[model samples]
Target: MYGVNTYADTNFASITLDNDVFVGKDNGYTNGLYFSLYNVGVGLRPNFWVSPLLWTMPRGYAENRINVHSIGQTLTTAEDITQANPPEGSLPYSGLLKYTNTHIVVGSRFTDWVSTSVGIVGPAAKGKQTQTEFHALIGAEKPMGWDTQLKNEFVFGFSRGRAIRVLASRSDTMDLLAGGQLSVGTISSGVNAAIMLRLGQNLRDSYPTVSLASSRASNPIAVNNSWFVYAGVSANYVFNQIFTDGNTFRDSRSIDYDHNYNTFMTGITYTIGRDSSLSFAYLSSFSDDDTEYSRQTERLNRFGTLTLVWEF
Candidate 1:
């Protein structure tokens, strides 16, 4: 048996300032905090051919609190005042919240040409306002020739609102994923690429929104009929018994919540001796919303990650 654990904490802050020849003071500032915990465990077969089983768990929390002030009076929904000159007032809004998640997964490979895995995920606490989700997935691949390969996968899952009643509203929503890949040149050292697509949906609930109306209610909106596409490329090199591979990456993990979008990533790996190696990767997302009110239309958000691994 093998096990590992890690923890991390990070903070971000920003400020902006403007000075005009004939205007009131103009400046703004914002700040945020993030914390995380991660853990993993594994068991291996002595022969290294029967395969191994691994499990992983991670948890994170983030909060954004901001305040804005202007030398001029800004019109609130309650104000009907017109202004030819800067108004004399300040308007500020701030928010604070925390979230927790729990995950359990089991995976194994049967041979060099085929593999499969599945998992269950949900929140650990009750009375918490968060979506509880469950997922199951399986995948397989086979060598098509000396220089090419084919693969396919399928995923089905469901997400529930804050209460059990919301979960029972449906038999459990469904999702699907399928894909394939191909390579050119030497089977052991060359270039390769793959494309994958995903489709899924979620149930409706009492979500929040900002509108001119004083009250909001839950409505039956179409849940499902969303689709996503991902593509990536990689290069591999081998010298004697040592080898290395690097690849551009892509993913659509958050497409269901943020609307259809795409992410790009790149990574590198080096093999040492015959049965062990290390690798690192980075990923980022891009906007694809067509509507003016979508979050991606207002601001661009990006993320970066690093990973290391050893195999035997």
Candidate 2:
């Protein structure tokens, strides 16, 4: 929750799950698991790598600042995972294991975030084992082509963005927010912007970071009880995508990926007490203009997210 301006100094933890199963699909970004610690004493020392950004933190009006560390894994596969060798021009199998650190600042009506992540993709990420075993446990069809997945590669990424409250209803029960983000790295590179319309109570208790910014969870700490339902849309321009572009250093399964797309999402959040919240969201994507890769994997782009945040 970056724009609350009066947030308390407390620690929080969260778990987020993203899966296509809820939408009755089994391939293409099939599953994701993430965990985060917010404002906890992780003792992140300032170093040459991050000092400049640290110096940029706004003063005076900036009322809240928090550090967040997160670790997560995401899995993607071709449309047909059961095949020993998937068809040509389909999504390739890949998995990512990532750890990120984010610096957040909240001002009178604006929130800003700067984040960096390090990760690996390929066998080292254990995408094959995680997916196959989970499927076996659930009695689902096993994915057989992980052997042909992307080769191992290390990835580094950085992103910075800001979201601001642009409008609010007289009663303070409805608001509209907008923001833009830019990212670059070996994993992927892109720029995106989104607008969200929210309706609920205590709208100032927290900011919209989850579905709006593609972050995994909302703020865990709240000033008081709060709840909201939101719908949002984002447009993106991707310069590169390692998953569909194949291994960064080696030739491997890959596709002529789409470079532009849009996402639409709707969700609701409910606060329990003043220190916990649960959220559920459904999201889907589409190419701005019909493209081969987009058309091929169109049905595989819908997914759902469930996140729980609580005080530590």
Candidate 3:
């Protein structure tokens, strides 16, 4: 089990400062704040659930993802802000800007080397009701060579689904994610390395995903509790706009510029009792166009993550 520590790395929760696409209720005025924000998620992972039917029958998971951002100005009420438009860079950050999501998934072993999972997602923000997501995945993992301490084997797997939204980023809600990760040690304890390529024919084109930033959310099948300090990098050739004003995929015209970017991430985790653990990570983005750059120099574009997890 694990969670991201946003304050530790400001870049982890940066919000988009788009001139348009604010409060879902009123796009003309934006509640989207500066890039610095925080995100926290908690979930219970797959535990042995079905043994009678097929031995390694079922493993289920449930989680809630939350993003917290600073809204602007004390005097600028929601009604007051609707009348005037803030300039491109200056926003009236007043209260807390937030996005909340809940997700659940269940998986079962199909064979000694393969398994499958299915799940649903529900997201809500500022009283806005968004669409729910349904997804299913199939995968396999097995040991490589025979070494005692390095007894753990290399793992290879792939998944495909529709509406698989990894992060709150609107641009990230792709039709599928088709990549995997590798651990030098065992899954629980190890120096890990991973790469994921985002693929999609359709974009959800929602507010937070497209409006605030272009970065994708956490990758699927996260590292287990045994992992300590680990670092990884990511690069993507997004066919879609990394950031947009409103419509999502079509919000911006077809352009090849600033479509490719990279991310560098590292984090440490600590275990709690026998079933739970907490973790923190620092992530940075390298791109010509990213939400990382903010007019509020006081607010560093530092990125961070905190997550908490458990098993029943």
Instruction: Give the best candidate by TM-score.
Output: 2
Q: Which stretches of candidate 3 lie over 4 Å from their true place?
A: 1-84, 88-124, 127-225, 241-245, 248-257, 288-302
lDDT winner among the candidates? Answer: 2
Cα lDDT listed for each candidate: 0.18, 0.74, 0.26
Instruction: Give the per-residue lDDT of model 1 (tens digit) for 90-170.
Output: 111111122222122211100011111121111111101110110012121211111110111121111111111112124
Q: Model 3: which ten-residue window has the lowest total lDDT? A: 143-152
Q: Write the per-residue lDDT of candidate 3 for residues 1-312, one digit (tens) a residue.
A: 322221121113322232221112212122222332433343422222211223322233222232333222100012123223333433221212222221122111010111121111111121111100100121211111101101111211111111223332354333222222211111111111223232331222111121112222221212223333445555543332111111122221111233345556554544566444454555554665445232121121224444443333
- Full candidate order by TM-score, most accurate first: 2, 3, 1
In candidate 2, position 183 carries an lDDT of 82
Any idea what lDDT model 1 has? 0.18
Indicate the worst ten consecutive residues by lDDT in candidate 2: 40-49
Error of 3 at 93 (Å): 11
Q: TM-scores of the models, in the given order?
A: 0.23, 0.90, 0.33
Q: Which stretches of candidate 2 lie over 4 Å from their true place?
A: 1-7, 40-60, 208-223, 296-301
lDDT at 204, model 3: 24
